[model samples]
Target: MNTWRARLLPPALAIVFAAVLCSVVLLVSGANPLATLAEMIAQVARGTTAVDIVNTAGAYYLVAIAAAIGFQMNLLNIGIEGQYKLAACVASIVGGAISLPFGLHAVVIVVVGAVVGAAWSGIAALLKVYRGVSEVISTIMLNMLAIGVVAYLVPTFGELRGNTQGTKIIPDSGQVPGIPFGGAGTMFGLVLLAAAVGVGYAVLIDRTRYGFELRASGLSSTAATAGGVNSKRMVMSAMLISGAVAGLAGLPEILGRDHTFTLNFPTGYGFAGLAIALLGRNHPIGVAFGALLWSFLDKSSLTLDNIGVPKEIVTILQGAIVLSVVVAYELVRRRELAAEQRRVGRALGTAAAPAAAGTGGERA
Candidate 1:
């Protein structure tokens, strides 16, 4: 209960702060901040929008949770961008290739996409574990490389979906098929995916030995090693699992949900995931809510045109929220470190004082 409250406070405060700051900015920009917020809420209530904000939120959740898992292990799988891309490509290509029944085809696409994502991500993990490459640099480079690979493969070999230059749109038989919501844009599949992420991530972090070791290592590498945990293995497993989660995001996006492969269907879900992970404090459950909040903000920002607010204003709001959260986290971390140092220093001082007193007594 206490833990839940503790996790909830930061985001709650951030939202309030963001609201006030946005209001001030809006007032200065000759727009009513209150009106802007109301306009956004009204749009959501009216269910008259070009995009499904909730569904997009689900997409961000998928990516953010995956990246958060990697972050927990002290590994920044910047490769999530590449991981999602490769999974989308591999799954779309392989899934469209098969002509199975509807249910079977959906399953095939999801599984294939996830596996492909993990496989692609494994390259970064392999480099870090074996070749001594930093995941940050490798993942970023690999993301660009994956993009090139996709361009080459799609134009050259062609997917079974009937593509001449790029892969063809997936057939109905291969689609995960979304349930109607509001105006038939939002899907029930999204709800299921969110639940699965929450449950799966929580289990991976709390119920597994790997999670325990990773947490320990994140806290202190030397202590983790002393505890007999194979730090290197933990790091590799962390990367692999993180990659797998990132791979899963592609399922609902390309192969499962869209049944199509476009040049860039993913609108920066990977980058958004990093922000979500940070905001949620890297807790799986917290991250879930964070994804929802981001999705709301992101989708509503488009509606700014209705109230005459510039799009850049919305971006500024997001930047402010991210900056505030980062600052708060750093401050909290510093205080904890300072407290720890004081405790250690006090113990050393006490031990030395007693030793000096004993020496004086013996000399007298």
Candidate 2:
């Protein structure tokens, strides 16, 4: 049941249910659901400018991977949206501040961006370690702070200034070029995200002894402490890693997609990332694929409706997909726990039976 394939099946089935429900919605709305779906298919075939979708989806992927890493440690980073906002602002300001060579400027900007995002999240980590605040609540509150502070900084000081908006478009030197043919830089964004995920898997799950300790601590923090693992350090490290990934999402906007920080750019990327993490079973590769599927549906929505499908139909289906995954994960988790308990009980019972029989034989 812990296998990726095993966990994936339930979500896949749920998606099928969602698709059927969407069809039902189309029928009830007096639309030719099949035709509507076909038109949507055609639009996807025609309108998908690879670079744009890939870039936007890359943002979603980075955030999803970040949350998924936290999830692996049994930590929930619900504040990635805030983390990204602050990080993007920091990156833009840093990029604009320096007049360095192109390579150094981009590197410095990205590093500062990642640092700021990590530092912002470190606040929540500090609270969890010292004040015993739940990361969920603390991060959520921190998100509010991030949104306000960045929102202020972008308009007031970031490059998008003068017109009461965010920073001006990032300089051409700071911007990463698109794939040779152009359109949007989404594919390039996706490539960077892939690299990030690979590095993340290596750093978080394999390369370091910390990965082993973190896994042990995540499964049972108290037991891991008894075993001499520094669970506190692992917690902070996990949070910092989550923040760094969130910051990388800014690359899509700052250097790839938008080329500048905006006051209220759509934050659906971060929100969708959370869902993708859950649907992906918190694994890096799984989350990437989950992000891809999520991005596809997102890109397809408007086109689908124009094909006669009602908005309510896709909306309900999408919502159901999340709900179904949540429910199924819970169910699967419960079953696994129950099975483990039963196995333990049987082992204990067998050991006790042997002891009792030996004692009785000796007494007789």
Candidate 3:
């Protein structure tokens, strides 16, 4: 098979298979799949629904890119959940306390979030590099630690009003303004930040020497070290970059929508990002599509209950898509490996035959 075909076919097939399977399931459960589809389509056609999808997708895009960075380096960095939360907490406090010019204040809050996230992830990186602690284990523990710290500090240092508990509201100078879309919806201005992050991620991973080193390290640490790639530094750098991007995952809500870190601030976005990253195969463009699809499903699911269709069907469909895509990709990878080995074997055989004939002539 052609290399590009091999790369593209699996994902395409996975989507088809998942859709067919979901249709069958819906039919078996006595629901009208076409009606359900129409409902989803009608709901998404609304301007408000479109705006909500874009707004949510912006956050998912940041989270997916963050996970993709670690994934490219073979790191899990499960602490993304904790990293974003902690960064948001600290950034909210700092942003609320200060009153600077609009642009500078926003920049400071973003910087504070990125720095705190990187610092939190650094703990897992150091443990992995120096103490041989598995990042999966360490990051998981760090997540719990982060939550505990946030819980403790919020009550002590954060402000609380009657029936509302959260950090102080950020002043207008620190808030991110929204772009109104014909009064039907207001899009978060931070969507530009998400776009910038995507562009930066693409450039960093595809065009830079450091990206080559990171890819090499992920492919084979021993080989990367043999080539003088400095595996430790690459691992640390990737982790920090991942965490820095993770920090932005919550900023759309914080700076644009919420203006403070409330106890009810969104959670679980990081875990959703992990799934999106997997679905995207860690590619920036792929991640964008994945984020949009995930967001669409989430938004469209809201209308499912109104039509007497189980909303849980969307959850099942999502799970099936992820599982199917993963299996398809793995199969493609193995097939590619086998094809490469066969090509190498044929080349070797042809070369050996020429050398053997030449040796026979000499011996004769």
lDDT of 3 by residue, 1-364 (tens): 4767665767677777887888998999999988998998889877699889999999999989999999999999899999999999989989988989978999999999999999999999999999989999999999999999889767766788777678888899999998998846889999989999999999999999988889999999999999999988988999999999998889988899889898888888888899889888888888899899989999988999999999888888788888898898989888888999999999999999999999999999
Give lDDT per model, in order: 0.77, 0.76, 0.89
When summed lDDT is taken over every stretch of 10 residues in candidate 3, the lowest stretch is 1-10
Q: Kindly list the per-residue Cα lDDT of model 2 for residues 208-317, writing each as its tens digit.
A: 77888877788899999999988889889999988887887877667765677877566756777888888877766667777777776766666765555655565677
TM-score of model 2 vs. true structure: 0.86
Better of 2 and 3 by lDDT: 3
List candidate 2 stretches off by more than 4 Å. 158-164, 181-186, 334-364
Clashing pairs in 2: 51-186, 54-186, 55-186, 159-167, 159-168, 160-166, 160-167, 160-168
**Estimated TM-score for each candidate:** 0.86, 0.86, 0.93
- Which candidate number would show the highest lDDT if scored against the true structure? 3
Off by over 4 Å in 3: 1-3, 345-364
lDDT by residue for model 1 (195-251), tens: 687788888789988778888888887899999988788887788777777887766
Given candidate 1, what's the lDDT at residue 331? 59
Shift of residue 37 alpha carbon in model 3, Å? 2.2
Worst 10 residues of 1 by lDDT: 157-166
Worst 10 residues of 2 by lDDT: 181-190
